[model samples]
Target: MSDFFEALPGAVGSPPQHYGNPLGEQKILVDGSAVVDLGHRGIVTVSGSDRLTWLDSLTSQSIAGLQPGDSGETLQLDINGRLEYAIRVVDDGDTAWLLVDADEAAGLLAWLSKMRFMLRVELADRSADFATIGSLGTPAIEAAAPNGVPLVWHDPWSSVVRGGHQYAQVAEHPGAEWSYSETLVAPSALAAASALPVAGTLALDALRIAAWRPRLATEADEKTIPHELDWLRSAVHLTKGCYRGQETVAKVHNLGHPPRRLVMLHIDGSDGVLPAPGDPVAVHDASDIADAAIGTVTSSALHYELGPIALAVIKRGTEHDAELAILSDGIRIAAAQEVIVPRDAGAEANVPRLPRLGAVRR
Candidate 1:
């Protein structure tokens, strides 16, 4: 058993407890005056005469409205409106920096480059040159941004700001009332901040699951659309002009309902284990497991405060209080549904419906 799992009380399973680095309690990182290292987050630069217009036409958010020093989250969709990538777009007057998942940076750059036939847009990966760090809670926020610079404090997600000439500070998984900032500092400064515990990718994943925030590739699937994940208000811009797959976004949102939907899962902590991403989540009361398969687990974690929690994508009408299960090699892990977004939000009401999935009509 790895030191990480050896320190824990649960039994270590097939996938070794440490696939990468064993991030200890140091995973959370905060300790009065400590600095921590944020795992793989990369930056993509988009520059050209038609940068704004080109990006505006491709992403789900309204990039045309972005002003200098402003940043927002946007989704890059495939031809069918399926999410290819979720990125934080930051405009710094001269260049537009896209902060994307490290794993997707190369693919995103290649895809965007191929599509730039005549458009004056250049896309390049800037991951090696930047470091992303998370600064959370009241103290971290104050320390990161001492002077209120007319910044927007949107909660339950990360936000960013360029530091010096080569660094940017971004927020990561801002949960409920808690706040965090992802600092993109220079590599030289990292050693100075080494005293701060380095946070592992697992900790960030757990934080995201606990907060019920959907992640790319995990919570989001090719068959899945943003609206079903309740990303309309955050990642999609209903008022924005046309983009690839805008038709599907408009059609489903205005005339049809998404086949599946995202929801929160609160696991029975007594079970002593949490389900991994891609695990099947079943409705326990059903006689046939296949028939009751409502969704797949996207992200999950054992929170210090919330115990085992997860974000899942289930059929729209699945009973909220229905008993849930995570099946792995004949082992049935118990779970329960916990609705994060209310069914009757005004924004969801405006969604157009067609071939509805018994989606609630407000």
Candidate 2:
């Protein structure tokens, strides 16, 4: 656990999620000054002269133009184009700071180390050396950015990145005003945040779910594609030169459809129970929970402002206007979908006179 988490008054434990005053602390986070200990988060550093270009050539985002203190994010895909890793990054001239989920850090570090063949890059897991402090507003996190290796990854969920596309056609994305940041802090800085009331993932998730932000830790499945969650808005640079799995990314965006789409659900929380991740979400066609589920909850939370909300990845074939329900704690909670990635997303939408679904195969 991070030192800051240890200093939290009611921090029960770590992993899976943290414990603290979620609803109460959420207010502190939004009202200008609360520091959150990112317990299950991990840190990795890549240092060398070839760092920028090397990373630029490897991931989904264009990192060649990275400058000192600049924040960005990227994804590592398998040769088959499946999402293998996701990272939040910031460069400090000499090194690249990568913040990721704790469970995935070893895999990311090992993969980076093994891929360093001829490149001058050096990879190190700095999870033990440094911790992360999160805040929705700048007041608390700004003061904790490491002085020597100062780096803060400001989230880009709000706007489209250069060379990337947005699948969300709404005039104003709820995330457009999203002002979240994660600051890298060492032991001393962690201690500095001790006085700040602590909160758990619930508080952070409420805001994130409301914004329709997809996270690597919670939203990933083996078959996950970046387009499914509209991650291109921040993580994938479409026109960037070749990298692993670029072909699939380009093909899907330009000529195919994402098999699944992301949606935000307003759950009926009258029963006072929040569905956890992995809960089955079904189309409310017949009120029976036994029917095959259409999707799975990626993350859920009881928002202080919005009652209850969740992000779910559902089959794209599911109708956009379909009523949905999540079966939880022996009760089905009714849900309404707020599209994040529209049902008819992708370049295929513009294609006309196409044959039936399996015509070519036949």
Question: Candidate 1 versus the native: TM-score?
Answer: 0.75
In the order shown, what is each candidate's alpha-carbon RMSD?
8.5, 3.2
Worst 10 residues of 1 by lDDT: 161-170
Q: What is the lDDT of candidate 2?
A: 0.83
Clashes of each: 16, 0
Per-candidate TM equals 0.75, 0.92
| Residue 143 local lDDT, model 2 | 39
Task: Identify the leading candidate in terms of TM-score.
Answer: 2
Q: Which 10 consecutive residues of model 2 have the lowest summed lDDT?
A: 140-149
**C-alpha root-mean-square deviation, candidate 1:** 8.5
List model 2 lDDT by residue over 112-150, tens digit each.
888889988889998887777787877654333443556
Residue by residue across 1-362, what tens digits does model 1's lDDT show? 11222232332332122224433432443332323244456678897778877887888877776776576777888889888888877666556777776788898898889879998777789788756555444223222121222222223243221110101111342344335445555555544444333444455556566655677868877677776776664677775788888888877766566667777787886757777777888888656555567778888776656677888888766765778887755567778777643332223336454767867768
Clashes of 1: 16
